[model samples]
Target chain A: MKYKDYYKILGVEKSASADDIKKAYRKLAHKYHPDVSKEADAEAQFKEVGEAYETLKNPEKRAAYDQLGSFQPGQDFRPPPDWGGQFGAGQHFSEDADFSDFLHGLMGGRFSQKHGGATMPIPGEDFEVAARITLEQAASGSEIEIKLSVHEPDAQGFPRRVPCSIKARIAKGATQGQRLRVPGKGGKGLNGGRDGDLYLKIELAPHRLYRVQDHDLYVDLPLAPWEAVLGATVEVPTLSGRVRLKVPPGTQAGQQLRLAHRGLPKPHKGEGDLYAIAQIVVPAKVSERESALYQQLAEGSDFKPRSHFDLEVADEH
Target chain B: MNIEISEAVWLDRAGVISMSELAQLSGLSEAILLQLIEYEVLPPAASAAGGPTFTGDCLVTARMACRLQSDFELDAAGLALVLSLLDRIRGLEAEVRGLQAQAPRRPHKA
Candidate 1:
């Protein structure tokens, strides 16, 4: 196994006091905490720091580790033959099996047990991964196949990921960042311990025609210039199916028309409402006859555009 | 490599874990768990004859509490206070996410 330099991991000297070690560990723990840190490898770094602290915090373990003398980190080295026997004199170390194989070899079997001759029970570490799904899948519950990296022990008891896939059921209306738990699918257990859980955080993919707001769904309902001026029946697409919507007379752009109980499904309550937003569009190129008709209508109409702007200018003057 | 799919139980969604199961899963001793319960660090989902029954979330809390207590040597009351604050922080974060999701979307560029 590769040798680990606990002092370097903790940023402490070999002659550093336990109090100094504790302070250094505290600083690193806060800096690399998974919940608060933004660093890319914060979780891994935090585990390494924890492992280093676990060994150095105890005087017996520290003394025993110091006896091996200085060796570069990642250098292949083996512990003394009777190194594991020394664990009987050290403090009880109850932690997850996140330490490196070097530390494991140093402590040996004695560190793997607890109490009066009973094996220590250390549950596996939990794993979390984000899974992206489409809006249709969110609207109608679907089964999704996802990959998870599960840890398994080698012949020497070192942890390594064995890529595995499982079909997960995503319930309808699964919100963004909602956790779907699949228990006993995490890192491997130690000493015949139970496995940890796997949590899948839901991420909804962006839709071309729809935007989600909680359970409410929003879609831009495009209309022609003439249609916006005069009311017309329009077909709107919803999650379930297409439905005819009545466009009120003098419908303005950027207006939202609500369709009740047509949005995403709720686990406990009725479905939310869907809003169809109005968007007016004009043809880019017009024929000569169409241009002439538009010119005639513009000349005949007495509608003054931005009349309120004139009033505002008068008020300012 | 030979790939395999493992069966998984929904810890937070489906199962109601007993005290012993929680203790084993969280790697916490019964005595420490009792102290934590007394201090309200870990709350149970249901009460029973053996003890308070917990779900997966409680098991998570227990693990966190145990690790923090070991590292910082925090008393039961202090751990409970910290845990309560952490819970409040998590709730606020979820609330923020909900509000952001409900915000109006910008129109797509033509």
Candidate 2:
């Protein structure tokens, strides 16, 4: 169907040595391996690199590919008329083989032969997908539905995409980035092999009021200036509900008030703690009478906030 | 569209799986899995009443080792070393994410 330049994909010359080709493939594989790589579209790049290396590593396949001559990548081109006679014919490739039609046409017969012409029990492929939930859901377990597109081989060994819908219950105390497994829920098995598993990676959606670290939750507790000065019982929001928290007299800004066992639940044992960070707020604008009262207080009070600045200046002098 | 409903199992919990189950899930043989266990790559979680058992996390690690070994032609020791390095990288990534969450956010402009 389309031409793909194996040498160009591998970043090697046509005349490059075998060792050079192998080295290039290794470097690219390490950089793009789906499990370890942080790059987007890493799985696609890895499949492309793997397909290119598969063809180039074998001398026979490489020779046949070289004889087909070069064309621009993705250019619509067909193999020569007698090409099928030189290589084995009547080999069909599935749409989801992850290999280009050109490589499949050139080497499909060898793949069949590599399997020894007998139907071997091939295990199903594992699938991984991300599942995003809320912090509240993580505290209390929730039910979720997930969809997956799996490739299943037909009677002719051509794989077709099969859409799967699974409903599962996420246990309580699930943390961010945790992986949950659904056994035998992945791609179907071939030749009586067992079905593969489905892995769901838990991702907690950002909460409007809370930030999570491990199981601990942190929330900002905004207080008025007078409320910070005098003791008050303020209502604080938690995952379960709201609770009244006592603000001691003269509570400082940025102080953390810990609410024991108010955070997310642990898997087996105790629950995590929640911290309410204090933030003192003042009125943006004041009336004339209030301003006069403030002026009187400012003159009456002897508190100097910039005392450290004068001390630092004197030390420098 | 095939709709299949099922329950999920958390790997980090105390639920343990047998060695044969691990081999079947990972697509590796029992002998090779034993060699990996000897290298401390796939450590058994505990010795259950029946026999030695592994946690569900071992299934993921074993599958990764199978793929890496086949793709790179690595030995048991080499696969173990790579797996350890990958674990370190994952730990660092989680730590970074935690720090980013704790960092104070800048005020939004109106």
Per-residue lDDT over B1-110 for candidate 1, one digit per residue giving the tens place of the 0 to 100 score: 44444433334533477889777766678877888888776777789998878866676577677767776677777777877887888788767765554444564433
lDDT of each: 0.71, 0.78
Per-residue lDDT value at A81 in model 2? 62
Model 1 alpha-carbon miss at residue A89, Å = 16
Please provide TM-scores, in order, for all candidate models, with all chains considered together.
0.68, 0.82
Instruction: Please report, as a value between 0 and 1, the fraction of native contacts recovered by candidate 2.
Output: 0.48
lDDT accuracy of residue A129 in candidate 2 = 84
Q: Residue by residue across A1-317, what tens digits does model 2's lDDT show?
A: 56789999999999999999999999999889887788999888988898888888999888878877889997766666665456554445443343353355346532333233546665666888889999988999888888776655445544445677888788898888777898888777656667778888899999998888888888877787668878799999999899999999888777788999998897767898888877876667789998898889899989787999999999999
All candidates: TM-score of chain A: 0.71, 0.80
* Candidate whose lDDT is highest: 2
Q: Which residue runs of candidate 1 sit more than 4 Å off their true CA positions? A: A1-5, A64-99, A108-134, A137-173, A186-195, A205-317, B1-73
Q: Write the per-residue lDDT of candidate 2 for residues B1-110, one digit (tens) a residue.
A: 54556778987747688988888777788888888888887889887776569987787788888889877878878888988898889899878876665544432221
Candidate 2 ranges beyond 4 A from true positions: A1-3, A60-69, A76-117, A162-164, A267-270, A282-297, A304-317, B28-41, B48-51, B107-110
Report the lDDT tens digits of candidate 1 across residue range A182-285: 66766656668777776677788988877776677878887886787889999999988999999887888888889999988864457878888888777778
